[model samples]
Structure formats: structure tokens, C-alpha cells
Target: MARALLPLALVGAFLLVAPPFLDLGWQNALINILIASLFALAFNLLAGQAGLLSFGHAAYFGVGAFAALHLMARIEDGLGFPTPLLPLAGAAAGLLIGLVAGFFATMRSGVYFALVTLAIAELFHSLAPHWQGVFGGEAGLSSMRMPWGGLIFGSLIEVYYLTLAWVALSILLLWGLTRTPFGRLALALRDNEQRVRFLGYNAHVTKVIIFAISAMFSGVAGALQAISNETANYVLFASGVSAQVVLYTFVGGATIFFGPAVGAVIFTLFAYLVSDLTRSWLLYQGLIFVLVMLYAPNGLGGLIHQHLRHRGQLDWPRLARPYAQATLGSLLVASAAIFLIETLAVVFSRDYAVARRDAGGGFPTYEVFGLDWTPLSPVPWLLPLALFTAGLWLVLQARHPIGALWQRVRAGSEPGVNPS
Candidate 1:
């Protein structure tokens, strides 16, 4: 109970401290962090605990968003209740969709399971653009103020708080689920499907229940997004968004309860920061995903776990040199790649216009460091490009040395190094 209560205390502390210190921009970012954490937790319900990879979780999100939009519209028209009652409409819609989807999807497992979910999402995505009455025919749906206790939802801050409340509730519920019998059964199914069946349990039913729960949580996220933003678009059902949620869940370490939450915060913040600075933010995202997949399948959480396990038991001296060498080489390689890309972009765009009006002038007029500064001539770009390539080559060469050290450690040749 103490362990369970710790996060609540931390949350209370954060809420007390954060608002006074944060500007509007940071407050908005905090809201986004909460939203993403909810979304990641929803995805992790099945992906992490049940070992089910879903590619169409956005279907529920779309449904919930539309439901919330409709409910808000009704409330505005005096056909529905106050603002607080609106989430129920969204939850009901989510539950209905989850039940239907779960029935069909639980028949398959592994890759086929994901494909089924994707197909459901794709079906909805296709219909959303053409189904005029139900989905608003590509124009999507709109939401309005709920007249909360005769108070109006006028500020972004209020919306942020509303989202925070919902997110807090959702996280609490999911955490509870993780400690329940159903959660244990879901993990059991993940480890040994045949064994679960041998115990006279209907594994399919267990899967369906977990999937529905996951879908419902995802729906809540979608509903929050729609209501908070005051709009819902077909883009909410897109495969790419689903893929990103999966990526977020995996990158945070699905094994631990808080792993997805951490992943969501980091991923969303990183994306926001990178996108603000560069047009090629997607490239960076892809790079991070690939590197994480290769180097840390269990993600940041897994790495932390490993470190904690070995920290006091192992000799610090033997590990320090190789770890430093690997870390520095990795940073150099990333820097070199980014430098080369910017250099090429500058050199290749020969007739690029420098808008001095936007930059406040005197700057070289290329885009870097969130400011306009670029190479005046192709030669400048070429020089840096060549230098970066050399740096990259040198960095790549260090990989060999790192690998040799890792191999020695792995082979049990290193004294005081714990392989386990």
C-alpha cells in the first residue's frame, strides 16, 4: 500500500509546485504529457501485460472522440446534462465499440491479432470521411462548453485541468487493474497460452476482457483529446498515430507499471522540442526508434533495471572506460549525422530565400538552433558536410573497440563483472 500510495503523493506534490512556476506554454506541455501518458497506458494494457500488439487501437479513440463531440453538442443544445456527465457518453461509446471489436479480434493472436485491429481502424477511417450523419463527413465533429455549474470553459488552463482530472482517474483505474486477478491471468496467457487453457480457463475470454479494457482506456484518451481541442478529425483514426502509441509504450519499457508513463512523457516532449526546431522531426523520431530497438528492447526502464541490479555488486573501474567510450562514440555519430543532413540541405538549396523580416536580421539566414542561420555559399556547407562525415567514420570505428570490450565482459573474462 505504501508503494502504491507513493505515486499519489508525488502527483500531489507536483500539482502543488508546478502551476505557480509554469508559464502558459509549460502548462500546455504538462497537459500534453498527461494526455500522452494516458494514451501510452491504454496501449500498454494489452501490449505489455498480455503480449498483444494492436495496430488499430485508434478506432476506439475515434469512436470516443466522436461520442464526446456529440455529447457536447447535445449539452449545448440543451439536449444533454452538464459538463461532468459528458464523459459517461464517451465511456459508453467506447465500451460498445470495445465489446464488438473484442469479439472479432480475440479469435487471432500475434501478427494476425494486430492486423485485425488495423482492419477495424481502417474500416472506420474510410467510413468517417463518407458517413455524413454519424461521422460528420470529413468535416468531423465539434464540441462546445458544458456550462459547468453555470461556469464557462473559456481558458486553455481550464481545459488542461479537465484533462488532468480525467487522466488521473484513468491512470488510477489502470493501476488497479494491474493488481487484479485479471491482470495476472493476462500475463499468464502471454507466457503460456496452452497452460492457461489447461487450467480450465477460457484464454480467449481473458484476452477479450483485457482488450476491451485497453480499448476503453484508449477511447477515454480520444474523448479527452476531442473535447479538450473542441474538435475531432478523421486523422484521429490514422494508423500512424496508433504506431506512435505502440512506439511510446515499447520505448518506455512495457514490463514495469510506470514504464509507459515515462515513455509517453519523454517521447511527447522530445517530439515537441524536435519538431519546433526542425522540419525533419520525423527522421529524428525514426532514428530514435531504431536505436532504441537495437540497443534497448526493454527500453529506458529495462536499462535502469539492469544498472540497479549490477550497480553495487560490480567493479566500477572495469566498466567505466568501455561505457564512456561507447557513450561518447554514440553521441559523436548522432551529431555527425545531423550536421551532415543540415549541410546537405544548405548546399543543395541553391536559390533559397532568406526572409530577414522573420529573423530580426544580421543572422546568416539558415534554419538552425530555432533561429535563421545558414551557409552563405555551397563551399561552407560542403566543408562541414565533409568534416561531419569524417567524424561519423571515426565514431563508427569506435564501435569495434566497444564491441570487443562487451564481448570480453560477456564471456566472463572480466573480474567482478556479473553476467546475470
Candidate 2:
């Protein structure tokens, strides 16, 4: 109980502190963070806990959003209810759809299961635009939030608080699920389904239940999004939405309970920051994902967990030199790559051509980080290439020392091992 209360307390503290520091625009962004966090958590519940990789979770989220929109439309016509309870409509829609979809999808595992989910989502995505009456075609649906009792949903702060409450509730519920017997079984299934089956568990049934539960929460997130925006669109059903949640969950470290939530927060903030500075934000996201996959497969959470687990065995003095070398080498290589990629992207862009035309150009001079160099000039290209090659060589040279240090740490972590 105390362990559970800790998260609640932390959330309460955050809710108290965050809004005062942020302006209206940032407050709206906070709402997005809450929604995305919930979505990522829902995805993690299945993929991380049950070892089921879904490529179509957005279908449930979109369905829930549409359902909530319909409900709000009805409520506008004398169906009396508090605006706060709107997410329940989404939850119901997600649960119903998840039950139907999971029944068939959960029958398969591995890549087949992922493909099935993707197909189901794509089916909905295709139908949503054409189903004019329900999905509202391309324009989608719009509904106004009616005042419920004394609490008017007129203000952004009110909506933020409401979202915060739902987010906290959802997180607590999902965390509680992880501590239950079913959660243990889900972890078991993730490790070895055959062994679980041999132990008399019905893996199929377990999977469907987990899938449905995950969808239920995802629907709630979609519903909250609908409420926050006062509209729902076909974009909600897009594959990109599903992909975003998956990326967030994996990058946050799906194996940890709060990993996806952390990932969502970080990714959302990073995107917000990068989008303002560059049009090539997607390129940065891709780079981060690639680097994380290569160096830290378990993600930020996994990296932290590893350090904590092996803290006692880690020889700071002995390993410091190699760690620094590796880190510096990786940074240099990444910087060089980023410089080269961004320069190439700018050189080939239509904007570059337009600018050239406007300037009556013989050739375009690119100004990057205070350095002005034309693409036709070999100096700009050669500098980055040389730096990249040097960094790569440094990384390779440091690899042996880093590996040896890691081996020693691992050996020291074992029982009856002497560091000396």
C-alpha cells in the first residue's frame, strides 16, 4: 500500500507544481504529455508484460475517441451526464472492440500476431474516411462540452486537472495489475509460452484478457484527447499514431512498469524542443531511436537498471578512462553524422533550389553552425567525413578496453570472485 501511495504522492506533487510554471500553450502541451503517457503505458502493458508486439493499437484509441464524440453529441441532445465521465464511453468502446479483435489476434503469436493487429487497424483506418455517418468522413466529428454541475470544462486548467486525475488513476490501475497473479503469469508467458502451457495455464485466454485491458486504457487516452481538443479526426486512426506509441514504449524501456511513461515524457518534450528549431525533427528522432537500439536495447530505464544492479561491482577508477574514451568517441561520431546528414538534406531540398533561383545562383552556399561552405566545395564534405572516420577508428580502438572492463565488472558481480 505504501509502495503504491508513493506514485500517487509524486503525481500529486507534480500536479501542484507544474501548472504554475507553464503558460497556456505549455499547459496544453502538458495535456498531450498525459494522453501520450497513458497510450504508451497501455501499449507497454501488452508488449512489455505479455511479450505481445502490437502494430495497430491506435485502432482502439481511434474507436474510443469516435465513441466518446458520439456520446457527447447525444448528451448535447438531452442525454444528461457529467462531462468528466466521458472517458467511460471510450473505455467501453475500446473494451468491446478489443474483445472482438483480441479473440482472433491472440490466437497467433510472434510476427503473425503483429501482422494481424496491423491488418485490423488498417481496415478501420480505411473505413473511417469512407464511413461518413459515424466517422464523419474526412472532417470527422465535433462536439461542444456542456457544463456539468459547478465544474465548467470551459477553461484549459480545468481540463488539465481532469486529465491529470484520469492519468493518475490509469497509472495506478495498470501498476496494480502488474502485482497481481495474472501479471506474474503474463511475465511467465513472455519468457516461455510452452512452459506456461505445460504448467496448465491457458496462454491464449491470458493474452486476450491482457490485450483487452490494454485497449481499454488506450481508449480512455483517446477519449481524453477528444475532450481536450473538442474534436476527433481520421488522423486518430493513422498508422503513424500506432507507430509513435510503439516507439515511445520501446525507447522508454518496456520491461520497466513506468518505462513507457518516462519515454513518452522525454519524447514529447524532445519533439517539442526540436520541432521549434528544425524542420528535420523526424531525422533527429530516427537518429535517437537508432542510437538507443544499438547501445541500449533495454532503453533509458534498462540502462539505469543495469547500472543500479551492478553498482557494487563497478570499479569506477579502473573503468573511468575507457568509459570516457568510448563516450567521447561515440559523441564525435554522432556529431559528424548529424552534420553530414543535415547538410545533405539542406542541399537537396526544394527550399535550397528556391533560394538559389531567388539569388540568381551559380551554386548554393550553406551556412551551418557559423560555417559558410558551398556543396560544390570539397572542404565542407571532407571535414565531416574525416571527423567521422577518426571517430569510428577511436571507437574501434576503445572497444577492447571497454569490453575487458565490462567482463571484469561482470566477474566481480558473481559470488566468490576477487577483484584483485
Candidate 3:
């Protein structure tokens, strides 16, 4: 009973705490986070569990959104349907399309499977603009949310709750599915497809079924997005959407169930809040992805798990000095790189040139975090360069000590090892 109630308690706590802190804009961002989480979760189901890398999952997502919009339009025109049930239309569409597409796509595996999915998605993307009657051209389809069950869906708060409920239900269902026999078989197939085939299981059919189910959930997310935005567009079918889900799942830790959820929340928040602050947000995101791939391939969740698993064995007092030094050195190197990049960017940017002209200056001083320096100044460039060199030297000097400490920690954390 305690174990069963833990999840409920956590969710209840989240529901209580999440809304009050967020303004309308942030509440909307939260909705995006929920939707993105579901999409990433669906992708993880296939990629993480079934070992099927799909590069065209966005095709199903777009189809669902378009289907939801069409349903809304139809209902508005006189078809009897409740507004709340519209997501089912999207789910059905996604499932049907997934069946057809998965049949052919699943016939191939590995890179061939990925390429087939990509081609299918691209085909839909190309057709969406030309099939203006159905796709509503570039503008896509828009519909107003009608009053249903004494709730007006006009306010942000209402929409947030509605999305939250659907997301919660979807997550529960997906989690439940993971505990079923089919889920175990999917895992087995992922680990050894030939063994599953030898065991008299139709691996191809299993893959197709899982693919369809994954697509169905992706559709649900897309449907919710359509209802929230009241529009669906060709951009939904773009390869970038699929790529974003892959990034979210992989970066969050595909090995764990909630890893993609963590990734989705972080990615959505960063995109929402950080993108407005800088035009180089994509560069930062790419850098993060590169770092994660290089240093923590299992992702943020894996890193967290590793820390937790080894926490008891970690000699914090002994390790802290080196860790702090290494961190400081790394930060200095990163800051230097950022400073150089920003300075060069400002020097060449039209916006900066205009700002400089407006300031009536020969070389306009740039201000960042209360520090003012001219982009053309040698001092600005030389200071960071010197810092970078020093930091790099310090890092090199500390590498052996850090490496030895890390190995010791790993050895101590091993199951059979004696910490002493």
C-alpha cells in the first residue's frame, strides 16, 4: 500500500505546487512541457525499450493534430461530439496510420528502418502543403474550444488542468503497459531478436504492434497540442520535431522510465525561457548535447543514478578540493570560449552595428553582467585568452589526482569490493 500510494502522493504534490508559481505564459509553457514529455515518452517506448530508432515519429504526431482539427471542424458544423473526446480522433488516426506505415517500416531494421521512417515523414510533409483542402494550406486548421461539461476552455488555467489530466492518464497507461508480458517480450526482442524469433514469437508483428502503440501515444500528445493551440500546421510533420524527441529521450536517460520526462521538462523550459535571452540558444543546446553524449552517454538520469548508487562510498572531504578545482578550471575555460564567441558575434552582427551607431561611438562598449568592455579592445580578448591558458594548465595538472580519486570511488562502489 505504501509503495502504491507513493506515486499518487508525488503527483498530488506536483499538481498542488506547479500551478500557483507559474504565470499565464509559464502555465502555457508547462502545457508544452507535458505534451513534449508524452511525445518523448512515446519515442522512448520504441527506441529505448524496443530498440527501434524511428526518425519519422513526427508524421504520426502531425496526422493526429490534423485529425483532431478536422474533428473539431466537423463537430462545429453539426456532428454531435463532445469537445473533450476529440483526442480520440487523433489517436485513431495515429493508430491507423501507424499500422500501415509500421508494416513496411518494420520490415527493415537498423539504419534502413530509420531511413524508411524519415522518408515516410518527408513524404507527408511535402504533401501537406499541396493538399491544401485537407491540410488547410500553410495556415493549417484552427478551431475554437466549445463549452463542455460546465467548463469554458478559454482560460489558460483550464487548459493547463485539462492537459494535465490527459497527460497523467496517458502516463499511467504507458507505465502499466511496461509491466505487462508484452513489454517484457519487447525488451527481449530489443536484446536479442533472433532468440525471440526462435522462441516462436513473431518479432515482426511485435515490432509493428509496439510501433503502432507508440504512434498512438504520440498522436495523443499532438492532439492535445492542437486543442491547446487551436491549430495544426505542416511544421508538425517536420523532421526537427522527431529530432527534438530523440534529443529529449537520449539526454534525459532512455534507460529509465521517467528519464525522458525529466529531459522533456528541462528542454521545454530552456527553450521557453533561455531562447528569449539569447540568439545563440541553439548553440548552447548543441553544446549540452555534445557534452552529455561524450561524458554521460546514459544521460542526466544515469548520472543522477550513478551518484545515488555511489553516495555512501564517496569520500566527499577527500574529493571536494580536487572536484572544486577542476570545476573552477572548466568554468574559466568555458567562460573564455563564450567571451570570445560573443565578442566576434557582436563585432559582425547588424544589430550590434546599429546599436553602436545609435550610441554615437567608434567602438561601442558591450555590457554583460555589469562588466563593460569594447569588442575591439585587445584587453578583452587577451584577458580571456590568458585565463583559458591558465585554466587549461591547472586542469592538466589536476587530471591524474582526479582520475585516481574517481577510480577509487568506482572500486568502492562495486558490489564485491571492500571500501577499506
Residue 325 in model 2: shift from native, Å?
4.5
In model 3, how large is the Cα lDDT of residue 287?
A: 82
In candidate 3, the residue pairs with backbone N, CA or C atoms under 3 Å apart (3 or more residues apart, or in different chains) clash, namely none
Stretches of candidate 3 exceeding 4 Å from the true structure: 1-12, 316-323, 352-372, 386-406, 412-416
lDDT of 2 by residue, 151-233 (tens): 88898998898898898899889999999999999999999999999999888999999999999999999999999998998
Q: Of the candidates numbered 1 and 2, which has the greater TM-score value?
A: 2
- Candidate 3: tens digits of C-alpha lDDT, residues 1-420: 685467659966887578867788988898999999999998899999999999999999999999999998887788878888888988899999999999999999999999999999999999998898889888888988777789878888888888888888888999999999999999999999999999999999999999999999999999999999999889999999988998899899998888898889888999998888767778878787888899789999777767766777777787787878878888888888777767676677897789878988677887654688876678888988998998887778777787787799877768899756
Residue pair clashes in candidate 2? none
- lDDT for predicted candidate 3 compared with the true structure: 0.87
**TM-score, one value per model:** 0.83, 0.91, 0.90
Taken over the whole model, the C-alpha lDDT of each candidate is 0.78, 0.89, 0.87
For model 1, the local distance difference test gives 0.78
Best by TM-score: 2
Whose lDDT is greatest here?
2
Q: Please rank every candidate by TM-score, starting with the best.
A: 2, 3, 1
lDDT of 1 by residue, 269-346 (tens): 987677777666788788888888898899887776656544555456765665676567566667767766765555
lDDT of candidate 2 at residue 48, scale 0 to 100: 98
